[model samples]
Target chain A: MAHFTKATSVHDWLDQRLAIDTLRRVLAKEYWIPKNINFLWAMGMVLAFTFGILLVSGIFLLMYYQPNVNLAFDSVNYTIMREVEFGWLWRHVHAVAASVVFLIIYIHMLTGIYYGSYKKGREMIWISGMLLFVAFSAEAFSGYMLPWGQMSYWAGMVITNLFSLGSLEFNGLVEWIRGDYVPGQAFLDRFFMLHVLLIPLAILALIGLHFGALRIPHVNNQDGEEIDFEEEAAKYKAGRKRESKVIAFANDFLSKDMFVVSIFLLFFFYLVFWHYGFAMDPINFDPADGLKTPPHIYPEWYFLWSYEILRPFPKDPGLIAFGFAQVIFFLLPFLDKSPNAVPASRRGIFFWWFWALVIDMIVLTAMGKLPPQGIYSTIGLVAAVAFIGLWIALPFITKMEKKV
Target chain B: MKELKILAIVVFFTLVTYWLVEPFAHSQMHKHVESEGFTYKDLPALTKKGDAARGQELVMGAGACVGCHSIEAAGMPAAMDPVTNSASYGVNPPDLSNVGALYDAKFLAALIKNPAHALKVEHKFTPESGKMHPMPGFYGAGGDIDQEVADMVAYLQSIAPKVDEITPAQAFETACGRCHAVRYEKWTQIGEKPSFKKKRDELVFETKLEDYKANLTNYMGKLPPDLSMYIRSRGEHYLSTFMENPQNLLPGTAMPRVGVNAEGAEKVIEYLEDAGDPKRAERDSVGVKVMIYLLVFAAAAYLWKKEIWKDLH
Candidate 1:
């Protein structure tokens, strides 16, 4: 790697004065990345870029959003939409970006599963990613309440009340989470703090750790092959780490990442500009009324799969199983004990099994969107069984597929 | 250089989008009549202040709040003919037990001045005779009714319990006792026992003993609906907006506007919530402690992870 800046002398002086060269080496230059990775690998950077947009747009929204129960909805409708310059655009971006970020993350996770990126040393990275997913879910939920619309209030009530399904202890825990027996100003105030400050800071720290963990083992490729770190270390001179045929992250991959970001932004901005309310509930435009509830109370689409998972069984067991479903993804590395980390392309049996889970997820999502009645209940039950069944059967399936 | 070019294109597109969508975004401001008038920032501070006693007086007397609204605390009578009123006004006015907790004080004052003014132009009084709100503006222009409206709002607030302090029994009594009898024993205890002749007259209204029943001369001659499980039947927020202007929320029914100010509406809402679920305040308080615990737990987990993985690099 070479320094392209014309202020080379100044940079060299700074390097000598502060020992800043090593920082540049580790963060900017010497780290090697696989040359064969494709567009799917770019999602991490895309997510980071999108997160930056959300932060910027969210700041603009926070400027006008009043977390008080009486003023919240009106603040959005009047101050943000009418009074502030370009405030409407920023609010729409903040909202629509939440849904889009979830979409990107879902695809990224799907890619990881297909390429077996969660295997072995990368398990912590996968786990961190899962934790981030949970944090993101919380962030989205808390942020949804800032508007204090009809949907916001009812959805907050419905989702928070889910915890009461547990025993006496669980009911106590639910009360603790809600801050009140019902979703009131207290709940709104607490959620506002979380959405604006606390959870976002945690997410930022988790993101830093996620990338740090990734740098340790380098990146995984779609081919599901390992680059032997010990052998590479041995090949290098005593003090220097071995380097591979690599792409410069700042020059090459950053360009690719930015290009994808620009294309994604085109669509994102289109939604913000033309179809701003595409992902929002119409009832949300109205101020929250404790006495009037929307006809249907459901979460945003990202949560529909998990919400469906809770539909099949009795209340407590269903909620526990729903939680386990999220936890089960973190245990994937241990569950797939086969020695080989094979991509779906080469592993025919695992490929079918994986798609089956995908299909089950889709079916469950559909069932979740419908009222749990008659045939929908039966369908939801079947999909829920298959979802859990796939996890239980993973190790055996992996072992059985050794011949492939 | 290529990255810079792509960045430039993205910036250009964003600017274009901002320009193109300005009209649509700005148009949204004028879309809802509720969005019209002064925001909280523009409101005079006095609108938020009121004397509950004075407000109560206005509600019962000059404001005519008692005519349409049935308030347990004030002991306001039910409408003469809820069925006929429902037919004329579009829907039956709801009781006012939790009105203070539901809306902003400024909104209450604005709505009281002109009932149709609370909604968008499309939703306001239509030329069709039955589509308009029965509520007449109580203040403005020739007379400065600010203090009166404020007092009425204060009285509404006085009736509602604190959000955290409401009990299910209190909620049921305040919000539902007027129309619905929850427990037979409780009903018998609360209801005034009519004399023998009066009971017979009441029976005649139900049984239609003769062609000309005394209550028949009343509007539509319909009894108020039972509220035994209204806590369960009506969704949250229904009564809040409904009480503001029944015609605006649900058109083509006989429910006249109840004229309970915003503070009063909030009290009614609190009562409704308390009736449905008594444990709300407790739940919210416990939630804060749970959040603090989770934050500490998260921090501890992060530190433990750092300790375990320190050598991995």
Candidate 2:
């Protein structure tokens, strides 16, 4: 309304009635973004692209996938792979997209944390991102069961059984989740609904909230100081010759984001084609056997950190700790209430603690893949302790640190 | 210029994604070609109905089932040369009273055809090591072998306990209680030897159950494993495959093959599943209803989120 464009005949009829031009300018064209953001920030767009690929490919896969316990694995491996046109491509794309989504999101989250993107007004944004992560995990887990392979069956059994450690009553909850004493047809059917329909809808809604929350404030920059978008807008209007600190969302940042996403696509497609089954466990090729249990029962790489947190404790307590580890990230924005919002490179002393936690996570991930015995168990305990300790120490340490 | 670059990137991304389809199709074809398993879906279906009575006769007579294994329902007493059998085979043959409840028909047929093949035994079993492969292929290209196997499997099914509401005691009896007596001391006085009565109609009377329990050690060369917890010790899958042919799971084992059909083997599996986890059915039924509740909750939550976020957007 403020800067109305002259009605061009092609879009004029729609533009006057629907304010299409205004919507475009507000949503895409003139939207303000910090100019200083590096390629690390591009991971957010990369994750969005990955989600798009998953949703489209998943829809294709859903057409052929049989949710029944008896036919699920065969449908994916035999019928869909051989009978359906381009079905193998869709399945691989969905599977490969899942791993890539996690990869991008992890980098995105670390970048957010390293740059203090969760500070002050961005609390809701950070929390919603964490919730998205939780939903994505649930989505991934439910999707994994669609194949009804040996690993999926046993993993479902092991994970659901974790809920039984509380009491006799809690054991009922475990059975309810599993739909049987173990994973079976009922479990597969329920998970199918969750994977294809329910969780994806929830994820879409959360992504909307994530973007909405992001729009309220100027994008956080490498310098950590928030840019004044109002001043930039005023300067642009006054015809100042100086270059704007804020970049236009449409042609500038969008192009850069898409360019990075394209580069990421090259890698993602490479993994899908050349190394299609790299992240997949070969044992999962076999159909679900309630009788034959695979010796090693480790989770996918992304979940290894949280899984490692449980190894040191006994069953009931270990499960409790694992649950806490997942929920603990939500409390991070409040815990580290640092007045300074400077990037990690400039944030003296705190950078070491941050990197230590990062390194600790890497170690925990490795330990998670290893059998929970001997030196690995010891390392799991030590790392878990250190992981929690960093959060506890964060608020106190940040408050005491000198301003940049 | 920027728009053209973006278009070029988009085109490149699309090309890269589709490029791998050919390779993916190749691997998928490879998977189909190489796949091999003794799954129930892959086995040939039986045209004729199995005869339990005929099966009983073949199991006791031609099958020579009683030479090694014991079935509680048949009152079949333990093998005569327990020591010699154990010395030659390494362990005593497992009792087949619950074999019906432990394995399915396909596994049983595969085992009866070739014990070594059924067990997935990788060891080179030759004619010289005939002693090592204790359970010979009974259906070795013989005419009427299929019918004989079907009858024997039916007979095993008849003797083996049917899968029902398996109480702890019944579960123990079927899966482990036969071999591993729960409390041997409670059943008999110290120094009292158990006895068995052989009769015309009964090999061992149903009344002298305690007597059979007392003589278990004499019949079994080595102490049998405690059955009270065998279901827990060996998982359901391992038990199914192992029951098909113990030699495959454990090489040089004295456990002789118990010839059963696929249905008989499945009955045993059902019994074991029931024995270890009796509440599976009840739990599964409740799960569907809970999911329905979750669906409603998810719908309500979606509406609520829409209402809350409407103004913000």
Candidate 3:
């Protein structure tokens, strides 16, 4: 308490940089935004907002959620299906929000990547966004096993086994995460805490940092111009007076973003209300039966790509060689020599970014949908190779030669 | 040059993260065939082989067994040791002081997998092990048992128990102590019965037909079934996994969540998966080998992509 001494005048004696006023000022509507940023920009906020909804809905579910493996399934069913009146709604909202968050975040990521959002001063924002994605996945994995369903149990089993593959005396890894082998009461309870508490806390902290990094100055247009802030502020104030418009969240930006939000909300709402939320598969309702493996168990769609990758690897086949040969995306920062980033033409290059994005999403989606091995695995190999050669390396070379 | 260094550093870190997290490589590098849809990475063979000696230290000492079990130490007071995190989770762990000579690895695996399944198989236990605790089926019970199970199993095989090196009569006395305390008292009254050991044998073998069938009526019986051949037939670590969730074998059984740790289940299953079935065992090794190879290939590929950054260009 003593450390938080009274502020010295308008400034603090301490070095706490962002007071509420400063935060508000930084986010002021009058701040110059990129003129050409279209509906695609809405996705970043949509990702953040949906995540916020997920956090709220998740908390409600957590209040009644139990992690006792024996009771985990029953407890989930009682609340979502029986006990709480709007429990189903809360549960469905959480489920749908999860899907929505992923959709928005993935598209947001593609937007940032293609447009060089990771370039220049914006690298930290991209990094934070990636971190948000990883944390969100952690949150999802923890929660997926909370219901103690067959898929949850089997999924946990399959993923956990990946740790011990080819020795490395990796059983300890499972114990470290699960606090034991197999997903049990102890494992589920800890996972529940991580899903509901720890990851969310980490995500909020990272989100704060993410937006902070986003507040860094943005580069403008194909010529790499800077926004003249003082001139823009003067123009904004004059226009405010001429129109006699007082900007309130409701009166100005909300009115516009509201229409966009309503459109997205309508689709989301239609899906939730009309179709039943994504289901806990029938087989999963029964507890995990180890001796009796399920006939066909697949991971959730989001993990399909990675799961596909794991389908064919031999246990002792040199892991580093195979894994490295295939999953090159994890090391992208090294492969390209876009020494000068901050894409000079955010508007004109939209076509290149668009096609690149389309190719990626299509292939990634196809790889995910297909069975993991044989022809499909071969296809994945080919496509991944093609992605590197065509979309990344070739473009980089072309762009570099042009500059030279 | 400065930019290149930064790129190099980024490459190094990305490789490190990828190597640490070989997300897809665990299964994709080989022609792995799982009869079941799921597969395991046949984990790398132990480079530092566990000394059966050090394994002993792990079981009773720092491994913190008593920390999550109903395990009793040699000088345990009459009161129950507070339940372990496992037992609080509802597992009824077997006492370990003299267990070494009593049960083989396979039988022990069942006990280790989940006490409920062990009781169901070894004792044909009808009643629930105890009231439900937070415990649920563990390691062998589900899809996610990992390598730590093998370590714990290795550790379990190294432990001494509450009873070992016993004559059949002594075995009867020790095992039936929980069920026939008064009968045991009467038999030891020193005058009428031939001898306590003799009487115990008679109680075991003599109570054959009517009592054997009738024991089914009330779940608790005077004797646990012979476990000698039980482990023999169950296959490596099969006992443990099956024991973790015995309803897999005997549906509608009364075992409530008894194994707490997936490792506990795996520990038991490694023993069971090994010690039990030898028929077609050598045959399955090929498939297991294939699985191992695939995983290794994936890991290597992942590492290569992560580290070298390009094909030796």
Candidate 4:
């Protein structure tokens, strides 16, 4: 409705029509980030960069990937790896990115928790980030099916069978989800669609919501100091940057992010080239056989903690615990009742709680990969119970903390 | 100090997880099997050296190796085509061209005297089952049994090409192609199919295919799994050990101990990697370049970050 200026150049023309300049200023140029944050703060950018790599490499894979169960295995191992030039590079990139992205997400989430970044006003950022995590998990699970390997078929069977609701006899729900009695053509087709298109769309939307949510509250910092972003940003804009506790997100914060990302990429490509065997499970090299199961069946490393939670209990209880692990993370903002937004190191019992939770998760993840026999079973049960106990104790412990 | 502590915690957890998942869990699953008798040290014939010329004569005459297998590289052909051999034996007899270069010498001698004993598959071929190995054991046609086996071994070894010269494909064919088909390589268990001259020949071909499968299933307990992806699935170490002694992994496995020596096993594994994971070479080479590029980029990025942050207080 307002008068539009005459176009002077390409960007100016778009700015007049689409408010491009305003969008840029709002999104990047004027966006204030805390200066006290460490390299861990760059993990979100790393995750986003990894997602971009996944999208590009996945598209290349999709060009040759067959969704039919009959051809999926051959298409991936033979056609892509053998016939297509540099096909292996794209595959290693996609596989490694799919795996490494989870590692970065965990770091980002832990950094959030350690600094109480999910407190009060920053709840939406944490919630949206959690949603992105869920979307990514779905994407990874579906993408795993595209290979149609032994682990793919069995892991899909195990996970989808969970939807049968134990004693509830809701198997129809699982069949509906799989689109078949077993993971066959129908299942592969639907999963392929989800992996390539549907879940990625959901992830892109969630990523937008996550970034948008960060805009309102700004970012939390290491010392959990209550930063006056408005004041600091003004000082930064007025060239009094030395005393300012904030920096513009454009070149200043981005430079730091790029530095971290380059290092992350070094680690990532190292895996892609020499150590990609871990990402591509040895069992998965065998094409999916409905009759033959591998000696050991487990989900990828990222899901191992929750999987261990499910395994250490009886059917219904295990399902309940598994569900608890999945949903409890979303409730973190409401669960921690501390008034302080300080890092865990200064937060009395929560410091121990933070370390205990990290160690418990590591144990659970390790236990998940192990065969549930002898000592591993006992250790797994303890870790799983401890995980639930930790969450239940979080609110009580935080409520007892004195306001900083 | 806090960051260092965090890094230490991360590294410690990573190593712990790796140990638990890979090594410790693997040990729990596959308790190491003692391969004490796999070398055939108990067989006196294999322990002694023999004359290569006598060995060649035994193979060409009394040993009857050419009855089922074609030592084509050594200028000998089987009595029957692959299809015919597969129909009769339930699996195509592999060409013996690379066997000398691929199999352990003791294993070859033991296999010749007693196929079931060498493979540790005597349990499957027990007299009660009324089942026996397709190849009849040679006892020494009016000669010393040990001397005859020793001569045959020497002959086979003499005819064998240098171990390094044997390609991975040749190694795989000699070691595994009889039972396992690598469809990616267009290599089938029965080798080449015979062309049908008439409608009855087509039916006969189908019958032969069915007979071959049935025979393999009866002999091996089940049809051997395709080796197309086994290199990726079972891995190099598992495959090597399994080849050395199948019963070590699966106690009742129908797979006979092929007795592939260390070098032979390496070649077979190399071939499997080629068929299953052809991109490995490219991945390694490209990975190194990518690592170098990323290192340079990271160094530049670090410098840029330092420069930008120098303006900050």
Model 4 C-alpha lDDT per residue in residues B1-313, reported as the tens digit of each score = 7666866776676677767666776677666765443354554446567788988878888448877778887787777866567667756777777788778787788888887787787887799989877887877767887788888888888888999999887787778877887877776666535566899987876676667767777657788888888887887777877887777788888887778777888888888888787777777788788888889999999998888888886
- Backbone clashes in candidate 1 total 54
lDDT of 1 by residue, A208-268 (tens): 8898889876778657767764454333324332243244454345555555665566566
Report lDDT (Cα) of residue B213, candidate 4. Answer: 68
Candidate 3 regions with alpha-carbon error over 4 angstroms: A1-23, A165-169, A219-226, A240-255, A276-283, A312-335, A339-361, A384-401, B1-313
Query: For residues A217-327, could you state the per-residue lDDT of candidate 3 as single tens digits?
Result: 542222334556565456545754223212322224333344445455645554444432232333454455556676556665555444544444455553442354344
Candidate 1 lDDT over B79-163, as tens digits, reads 5444444444433454566556444566567666665654333243567635545566675333348877887778877887674
lDDT of 2 at B248: 55
- Candidate 2's residue-wise lDDT over A216-305, tens digit each? 875788788767888876664454414566666765566667656655765676676556554555557656789889877777767878
The lDDT per prediction is 0.64, 0.66, 0.49, 0.85
TM-score of 2: 0.59
Better structure of 2 and 3 per DockQ? 2
DockQ for all candidate structures vs. native: 0.02, 0.02, 0.01, 0.71
Question: How does each model score on TM-score?
Answer: 0.57, 0.59, 0.50, 0.94
What TM-scores does chain A show, candidate by candidate in order? 0.91, 0.95, 0.80, 0.98
Worst 10 residues of 3 chain A by lDDT: A242-251
The superposed Cα distance between candidate 4 and the true structure at residue A180, in angstroms, equals: 2.0
Rank candidates by lDDT, best first.
Answer: 4, 2, 1, 3
Error of 1 at A196 (Å): 1.3
Clashes of each: 54, 20, 87, 2
Per-prediction interface RMSD in Å: 16.3, 16.6, 23.9, 1.4
At residue A289, what lDDT does model 3 achieve? 52
